[model samples]
Target: MSRLLSKLSGGQPVASAPVSVDAHSLDPQRSAEMLAGFEAADIGWFWESDAAGRLTYLTDSAIAAIGAERDALIGSELTQFLATGDSDDLDSTSRPLKFRLASRSPISRLNVTVQTSQSKEIWWEISATPRRDANGEFAGFHGTARDITKSLAQSRDSERAAQFDSLTGLANRLRMARKLDQTLTAFKKSKRSCAIMLLDLDRFKKVNDTLGHPAGDELLKQVATRIKKLLGDHGEIGRLGGDEFQILLPDMDDRGDLGDLSKRLVQMLSQPYSVEGSRAIIGCSIGIAVAPYDGIESSELVKAADLALYAAKDAGRGTYRFYSSELSQNADWRQRIEDDLRDALTQQQFLIQYQPIVDAKTHKIASLEALLRWEHPERGRVSPADFIPVAEELGIINKIGEWVLEEVCTQLSKCPPEVRAAVNVSPIQFASEDFYDTVDAILNKTGVDPARVELEITESVFVGDLERTLKLFKKLKKRGVRLSLDDFGTGYSSLSYLRDAPFDKIKIDQSFVRGCSADDNNNSALVSAIVSMARALKMETVAEGIETKDELAMVKGHGATHLQGYLFSGPISIDELLDRFDSKELEFKPRGPEKYRAERRTEFRKIGVIHGDSRYNVFLRNLSKTGARIEGLLDVPVGTDLVLDLGDGQLAVATVRRSEGFSQGVEFETKLISDGDRGLCTRHRVSPYQIEAAGRPLGALTNSAVAAYTTGSQSVPRAFVEVDMNAYNRR
Candidate 1:
């Protein structure tokens, strides 16, 4: 009896226990009364259910704790009052409370939620034993339940800490990885596509250097908030540590839509951020890779996306790139260039050429725009588009800018007083503290007239501190140098900046000028508005990239003050300019295409054309976004359906729209998009997995190769006669 009392009291000693108790004191009825009293006093409560799992009995205290009357809970279903908790050890073999009661099995410490009348859910740990009749038939269950809300809350907190970023309440690296694995596994079965985007803040390092770490943290939080607001229910986003973030978009493979979304992300992230009462500005670069096209698994997809991101950063830090098979090769080439660029400055491999910007009305030179050229010993002349970005990435653009400034000043000293020279400046160079001093020293050393030197700065310069930028402009103005806003309407052009900052000229971006003459194009109206606005602001306007006679005439009619493009002259050497100046021949005749045409890239390569069951060899003449021209087929009917095998698994469905003597103009059903290297590519390509399933290696296949493998047993059913290329060439 004493032992029983001690066990009921949870191993606590019973005070003044009789050594020899009367028979009634140790009776079963007495024991039941003591157990009931102990349960009412302790944190646990008792419950019972009938064989049908309906509540048969419950302690009055337990009923009151749940804010329910005895009558209300007596016949209620037991499972309706409780739900299973997220216990780590629960698995397939661990039966639920209802299943255990039905199977007449003992349940030990199973966690579940108890629903209450007050609409509150409380977690409880429960243990139950089955009750049976004298015939050994299952009857009901008797259980003890203790509230575990506090401990469960702590456990949940720990789990959240492990899975989420502490700084931004977004999923951390571990959670993102697991979720990506699960999503990919499921998507593979459904044959649906997924896309992953990897992005990193472009100028975040500058923010951390200028402000403190705490401020940087606040900036990241704001970035996450902005992303959430933009994405909403579209996708899942996670921070992959530091300034890097990852996004998982399910069932999205359209590059056009992806490109638009990426552009929006870049624009949103580039906006000004207010952190702790200080304004900060930054940008982000995105790299995208779609599943089954770029990769098949999480790791592969992540690596591909990272490579794309690297390419975007390499392309000048304010763009996005989609993954391609050739990106790995390009990445390697980019690394080599970055390594070689550091020594190119000392090797005397860089030179300057001047392109003449002429007056639109007089057709004479207004100012010579200085351009930088890099001559690689092995690779010949490297495009400025390629090397300038490398220089920016290497943090040597400022040094290169200073060199150009000094050289321009020296060149200006030799030119006529009316022939001013404009030098381009990068945002990195313009932000330097010593930029004004460097300009002053150059003018002083070269003894060039300040009026003959103009500084050309892009709109990106406005992304930094506006006050300091204005101060720098004032300092340069005090030195009598000219300031011209370059690529004026390309980016976020604000009228407020133009009104506040002193400038002498505004150069319309080439994009606006290229198609200004088209009847359907809005660029003509845009250019007219810009020119009129510039006139009102008392600023000179220069229309750039005037490659056609129509474009030149249109801009001139729009009241542009200056024009610069190939129609006047390509970039000329200093000696060539001096010769032209010495001969007193500044006026140049306009020479270029009369009207603008869609730029088609010329190509000479063999491809395959599949019509019906026959595949024929054809020569691809030229390619464009909308259509392609093919040769080696005679008298193919117009409106004939054919598939052009553009190698590398790019199969484009085209229709022969124009047929003439072995040359046909085929218009693609789906328009091709930019391949990020000034080349056009199909929006979707055949997956390598599909090729592997066809008993071929898992990689890109040539057009002829795929044709031979696909139509092995079938005989060719030629609908049109194939022209003999050798005979045709001889004729």
Candidate 2:
């Protein structure tokens, strides 16, 4: 190479016009040998430069093959094309040829992608050696380059095909599995958390069935685009076959964030899609699982997520659910609970607290309603919703009911003479033939006035033998004990039962009180109707479960004669009641929420707050429709936007309205709504974090090799490996 360049430069290094072959500079045999070597080896082209690194020589055939005129590239530096190479690709590992030339090092099989005259990339394998002048000073270089574009392109295409989905341009199942497994393993050692979301398009089958699979595929691609845009650069999404997708959010265990992201996903995907010039609508359900919390491994985490997904679907679709160990329990657990409930009263797990029912007219305590509480030895305080049905189904409610009556009578005998006690009777226990005698004996034994006791009955008693039920009611009323219906609208609500039965009071169910202030709600009207009917029957009316100021105002304006719920007071322990009774404060004051915007729910659950790429563990102390108070973060800035991960997949985007040490009050970007079961949910949410945990490709997928199907091109994409549905089904 040095001998050839020396001849081309004529010993003294000087910039000169590039010439193919100068017969005058070389011997005939040598020139013929060089030409033959070029033809025989099929080396693409060669160039020589002076010490100034200016192109002094160029091969005629190479210049023509590159779609370039000889004059244009002749005087240009060889590094001109290096600038236009794949320099913008962050993953590129190729050492640039320009740097090697600057170092005056020998270039050995260096690959450089350069643009041809026609604006096409032509990859070349370049090799060069520095030539020396007669004095052995550095002159220039002579090297050979061969086009390797085809081979390189083939290799990249194969790799992309193996890893990416051809349809949606998202990560395929194999890639997602590998990525998730790798991520969990790393996160586990650091004790960091990761959250994964499993979602499938709702009504996707109907789309396929009605519009055909092609349209479904198009809709899916659009869905992918929308999700990618929503997540932007925050997450990685993978298509795990059919309409199912898996999302890997690294370093995120905040269910609140995941839930918000899920809601956003459902809402976005559920929006009407214009496919094939026709409008189509669809929705989605999401299940979320976190690493180290749900599972340590990818498969276990995925299974947990799948269970949550089924739960979300079971919750009537278009929602998200977080995986919990409770979701894994079976029927055997219920049986065990039933057995435990039978022993609850005997084992001393039973306790009673009282909530006062106040007279609406004078705001004085009319009666204290006894509410049963059960604390399992192993399970702490068991919710009535969890154990009451078990007792009823096992026929243990009769003993439990009789014990509550006896216990309440004994306690009420010591209260002020005017103070009354109310005990709720289960329909099953109420129907027992000896139940009346037990109540009679308890009242006699305790020496408590029967007139001071109120027995709350449900409409369920009227289900069997109405004549006997009406007769039993009359017998009970004759005993001088007051009777009032409890949970009025929840059971077999029959006005005829009221007409014949001598009920002292009619209690309206709490369900009618909630949201009664809404413009479209009919609860106010229903409350008024019940109040009017009770008035005509000469029975007083009690509004039950009044929890909020709005509800209190609504029920009061509607003419309820009495009220009972948390607004006046929750169930107070016997000690607290004794203190109140001793103080002669039977007249309870409404000390509930004075502010209309007080915390809707005060919570202590740990959640996540994300600012930038950093997620801070915070306690969700209070949450409301438009704002939340988060603790555990120190000195957060006011006016900063943060995402709160409220567990499962619930995520709320909030801006810190007030900030102090370890606490921040934030206003939500979008207000939350009731999930129909007292839980709050974002209007649209899903977990999204700032970290590129799936290495960006999982969240940001726009690989061109698989772009044919994913890009917004009108043409059909090229071939890809097909999934055999028959074989897949067998598996």
Candidate 3:
């Protein structure tokens, strides 16, 4: 009874009321009465166990709580109802109460949760001391158990609240960091891999600015739900803060699978969300990094992923990029391009190129797509694909877009009445409040008929306020200009878009047209369906990127009205376009490749070619995933094995497939992977740590210095004659 008093007031909450009285010095009868009152109130239950650890004595209230007959429980083990089955980590945190009973040691304030046969959950804080028989031998034990369920739950909730985001109910940054560290540390020893993705909503600030913060918060909640649904149990997702999210997928090393997953995430997250009874659409960019390849440590991996994210955003949003060693070197180049774009804007160094869209049946010129170019004096013709996103971020895309409209109109004004011009519109430029006025001003200044100017709008334009977009399209159409949906079947495409959009044409994106007729895939069927839909909508369908005769035939047979691709003609200068028009030769014929070859790419660059133990400089005339052509080595047999060092930690083992004079074609032992920028790369790289073991400071890999670490080659007699391609070119 004295032991019971030591615990009831041992700073634990009482089931009913507090017992402040110290009964340690009280008479035995008074203590017994107090304990009896506790049992009657059901505040706690008392039980006794024999030396064998079997229950011997229990109160009526405790017996009822056990949900069993007294005879059944009297000889049962006390630990049987302790809920040990409910937890695996419990035994590691503290000594099992049953073990203490066997050792006859006293237990003070040990809390555990238990479930009865009836499945009732109860938390108990128990205190016990062993007793001795008259001969001083172990006899039995007595303990006091009290209900502490309420307090325990409150404490746990507080702890969990600290680790989770209140808005999204996901792990916070601190918890995610700890989780990543622990997983990476454990997986490193096991030689396993994990992939992490860092992503954030693109143009999310615009949502917060246009809509209220409450709508933004609701949008974030919807985003979290969408991500959780898509990922399911495949990965752990956390909301770092704001619109940023992180995902950790275990046992994932295959970059191909990672790329597919990243693509899905970007697409799913970019879908429109309903916020406060209004439709809100936003896009996302994702960056991926795999463990032991990108980095073994959590911090290093995170930094790599962050850099990739920046690259993806810089490339234009709604895309995903995987981390590569080249990204570190490209940081300065990215900034330089941004600065160049700004210069091009101020210096008016931009130029427009025109690609002809020909009628599918007549093969006559239908219209010309005005492609923007930045002709840098030193860098040659800079690609708009690489810099247009930068211009948008710099808030100069609207100005450039305005300039494009004016220039296109002015050029068309001098051309024949039937020669039409189609101009690409940036989503940022299209969303501006004064965009309509700018178009009106351009048309008035150029004196070109509105019918001759066709504005090509991508599906991304649907991302803005739907009502506003509808009104804007109608307003533009009311001015007698034609609207064409460009890049259809990409970026937030929905059938609902066509039901209301006032478009005269639908341009199938180049991606679908690339391999439509080559493979037994759905691309062909998709193009057919799109053409059928366009026909039903009384709109012309232009199959873009028909770079082969087969793709052209397939789309034309599917009832496409127009075709635009290199198969017809590549983009041309204004002077070249005017000359062709003056010559009155508008009909184009079939050209370009006979069929699509996805692996092959024509690349002219200097690469390191190694035969036996010697490495020599060679000119790589063409490159592919499985093979490449080199012009440097002579007298090499058709079956000779060589190593091609493609730089940036990429080494390919190859065998000569064809050899003649100074030119040889070699087939690779393994296929190369995409470096996330339409470039080839190796799946794995030589560990810099291995070089450190050979007596060097550890750092990132340099292909030239790390060749020994990769191939383990030593100096030996050169087996093939070497050729200096740079000097040979002069001949």
Best by lDDT: 1
In model 2, what lDDT does residue 236 have?
A: 84
lDDT accuracy of residue 267 in candidate 2: 73
Angstrom error of the Cα, residue 8, model 2: value is 90
lDDT tens readout by residue for model 3, 1-731:
34444343343323323344455566556656776687788876776778888877766777676577888777888788564323432445567666666677777767776646776667777777676666978777666677777787787678678888889988889889989999988987776778899987987877786778998898889899989999999988899999999999998867777777878888888877888887777899988887766787898999989989988887767888888777887787778888788778678789889999999998889899999988898878777777888788789899899989999999898777997899999988998999999999999988999999999998877764778899999999999899999989876788887999999999999878888986667899999999999999999998998889988989999999999998999999889878878898889998887877765778788888776567777889988888999898887899999888887556789999999999999999988877555566666655555665777664545665566554435556667777877786788
Which of candidates 1 and 2 reaches a greater TM-score? 1
Q: What lDDT tens digits, residue by residue, belong to model 1 across residues 418-501? A: 999999998888888888888888888999999899999887776646678888999899899999999887545778789999
Q: State, as a TM-score between 0 and 1, how close model 3 is to the true structure.
A: 0.88
The weakest ten consecutive residues by lDDT in model 3 span 9-18
Off by over 4 Å in 3: 1-47, 57-72, 84-92, 95-108, 134-136, 203-218, 270-281, 604-619, 643-653, 673-677, 682-706, 713-718, 729-731
Clashing pairs in 3: none
Candidate 1, residue 512: Cα displacement in angstroms equals 2.5
